[model samples]
Target: MPDPTDVEKARSQRRAWEQNELRDFLERQPESQQEYRSASGLPVQRVYTPEDIADTPFEDIGLPGQYPFLRGPYPTMYRARPWTMRQIAGFGTGPDTNGRFRYLIAQGQTGLSVDFDMPTLMGYDSDDPRSFGEVGREGVAIDTLDDMADLFDGIDLERISVSMTINPSAWILLAMYVALAKSRSLDLAKLSGTTQADILKEYIAQKEWIYPIRPSMRIVRDMIVYGAEHLPRYNPVNISGYHMSEAGATAIQELAFTIANGIAYVEQVAATGLAVDCFAPRLSFYFVAQADFFEEVAKFRAARRIWAKIMKQRFGARKPESMRLRFHCQTAAMTLTKAQPLNNIVRTAFEALSAVLGGAQSLHTNGLDEAYAIPSEMAMKVALRTQQIIAEETRITEVVDPLGGSYYVEAMTNEIEEAVNRILKEVEELGGAVAAIEAGYFQRGLADSAYTSARAQASGKRTVIGVNKYVEAPQKDAIEIHRNDPDVEARQIQRVKAVRASRDNSRVATLLDALAEQARNPSANLMPITIELVEARASMGEIVKRLREVFGSYAESPTF
Candidate 1:
């Protein structure tokens, strides 16, 4: 810590310099912008000094793996092991995506991140009319356990960590994964992966939900308790800020709302007579690494500090693991531009670098051609190599929290943490995350921020390199756009139909009835029955339809 007398002396000197040398320099050669602000609209100072972080306690910014964990969650960070390189890949039929999965693994990718199409994500079978022409368009289509098997046919579940990006029907997909593992005689305790089963974010941002909010939270709670007792290594729910960020949340809103949601989950699960420590360790997060370099870094650091304090003070958690905030980051896909096409590579690289500096446990870099469609094979390879180059060539991982003590970074981290706490307090006053969502608080906040950002960009206040400032000519045939398989829908429909034909209809009907009965109880652990339903060859649509009959569908209010 700096001496108080010296700090005051430095502050006096800084004020004098600002009025004299700085003022004269600015008069001679003006700055680029009259006012500078972060992507989140936080005011950026002309220069940060020790006076900026004078009020921050030394212990709050202590060494890595310490309490409050502002530096990082682990002592070694990337030195003991590099962050998992998980490039999301899923398109067309299960087999088609399986090929891409194999391709990624062979290219030195360390983890699997699955992206599901609209049908699967909405809990519909590929053969459903609502799913026609949309099967496997955005991502892979999985309607049955057979599809899940095909998706991970050659991959070993025990060795690789798989992240499933689904929300509304996330538990069903998790069931399929567990059933597939059981069919192959694998131990559930040893399986490691994450499921984006954060239904709250769907209501708050993504708008891809099936059941009403309260019922959906019940299902999430069931999954958390089950994962705690059964699959200890698997992360049942990845409380995500990525969707909210992509949906146009500013950095402070993203962190605040995400932490608030996590608090809600912890409260709901703890109400089930389960100890916080039992399940909190496995609770994880997902965030987006945006273009604002320093702001994004500070966001991640503040995320850890805020979560640690919440777990320790609010929840009375005794274990260190319960307080640690582990997150996987993906580069902002919304920032990619189709005009220059190749410039996305540089954008993704910088975003990825910020994620590393902020201490992400795993990361996914967006491909160059993503602005047009799902990334092509070549584009994905380039994105994967981006992580490789950072890990092997950059030498950044050799040191832990390299920017830990920087004056600007420390000040920014403190400011972000304070801002997030204020938002969390507001959410609590509004009766928690679910109530806030129902009141359209989060939705309205997102809309307001998005509108502000769009207006800024349109008015030339915010400059996007290729899109706004550079004024580059549109390139033709600059990159290969990923084309969807025309027969993917047909093949997927046939596969689901075949599984239905071959399955035990009587057992499936009985299991679906049992599932409905248990779902009505409100306290029953649904994971076991859900797993059994998939094992009996029940389609995803059947399971979801049964639950929907009991839970009913959700329709967002338009007033917000």
Candidate 2:
């Protein structure tokens, strides 16, 4: 901590600079905008001094890996080991995605993130009528254990951390992963990965929910409990603000809403007779690194602080690990543009840097061509290289929390933390995340923020370089678009049919019946039964169909 007298002297110096030095500078050249603000509309000052953070206590911004974790979650941070570089790979058939996964791993990518097709995400099979034409269009198609096996083919699951970006059908995919590991004689305890099983975000932003809030939350709880007890290395749920942020939430809103969702899950899990420490330590988060460089960095810092307090005070968690907020970050896909596709490379680089500075445990940089479609192989390689350059070339990792004591960053961190807490309090008053979702509170806030941002971009208030400011003439041959394989859907459909034909129908039916029975039982942990169903050769669609009969489908209420 600095001397109070020195801080006071610095305050005087700041006043003098504004009065004389800044006045003369402004007279010579006027400021560009009448008001400077961040992407989330937080006011930005021209200069910051010690006076900005004079009132803050030293303990509030303690050392890295300490209480509150404002500096960072780990003490050495990237110095000990750089964040895991994960490229989200999934497109075409299972074999196609598996090939891409191998390419990325061979390129030195450290982690794996799987993207599921629209049908897979929505819990539909490739052969279902509703899934026609859309199968394997957006991502890889997985209809059964065979597809899951093909997806991971020769990869060592025990070594690589896998992140599955699916929610509605996350449980089934997780089960398939477990079954695959068991078949290979791999210990379930050693398998590492995250099931992006945050269903509240589905109702709040993505709208990919299968069951209604109550039963869906039950599934989340079951996974948390099971993961805590059995799969200690696997993160059952990645409480995500990435989708919510992409859908138009401000940084503060994203932080608040994501934590609110996390609080709900903690409560739900605790209700299952599990101690807070049992599951809290395994709870991880996923967030987006948007274009606001300082603001994004500050948001991550503040998130760690807020979460530490919540786990300790709110939930009575005693373990330090339980209080530490571990998270994975991805570059904001919404920030990418098709107008000048190559410019996205620069955008992703800066966002990736922000995530690194903010202390992400793992990160996925968006591919330059992702604005148009799934990234091409070259585009994906470039994204992976972006992270490598930051981790290796930049000596920024040499120092932990290099920006910890910066006046501007500290001020921003405090501002974000306070604002997030205020919003979280509002959520608590509205009866937690589920109640807020049902009452359209979260949805309305996200929609309004999104509309506001869209309008700002349209009106040129928020300048998106390629989309708003830069004017480029149309050229058909300038940028390459990654086209989806036309044969992908047919191949996926035939593969699923072939697997069904080969599997034992009677055994599959019996397993499905057992799963449905377990689903109906209020106290049952669904993970074990889900694993059994997958082992019995039950297809993703068949298992979801059986559970849907018990949980029923959800239809969101219109919120304007």
TM-score of each: 0.99, 0.98
Task: Kindly report which residue pairs in candidate 2 clash with one another.
Answer: none
Give the least accurate 10-residue stretch of model 1, judged by summed lDDT: 1-10
CA lDDT, every model vs. true structure: 0.93, 0.91
Which predicted model would earn the best lDDT? 1
Clashes of 2: 0
Model 2, 139-223: lDDT tens digits are: 8999999899999999999999999999989989998998999899999889999999999999999889899889999999988
Q: After superposition, how far is residue 462 of candidate 1 from its true place, in Å?
A: 0.6
In the predicted model 1, the residue pairs found to clash are none
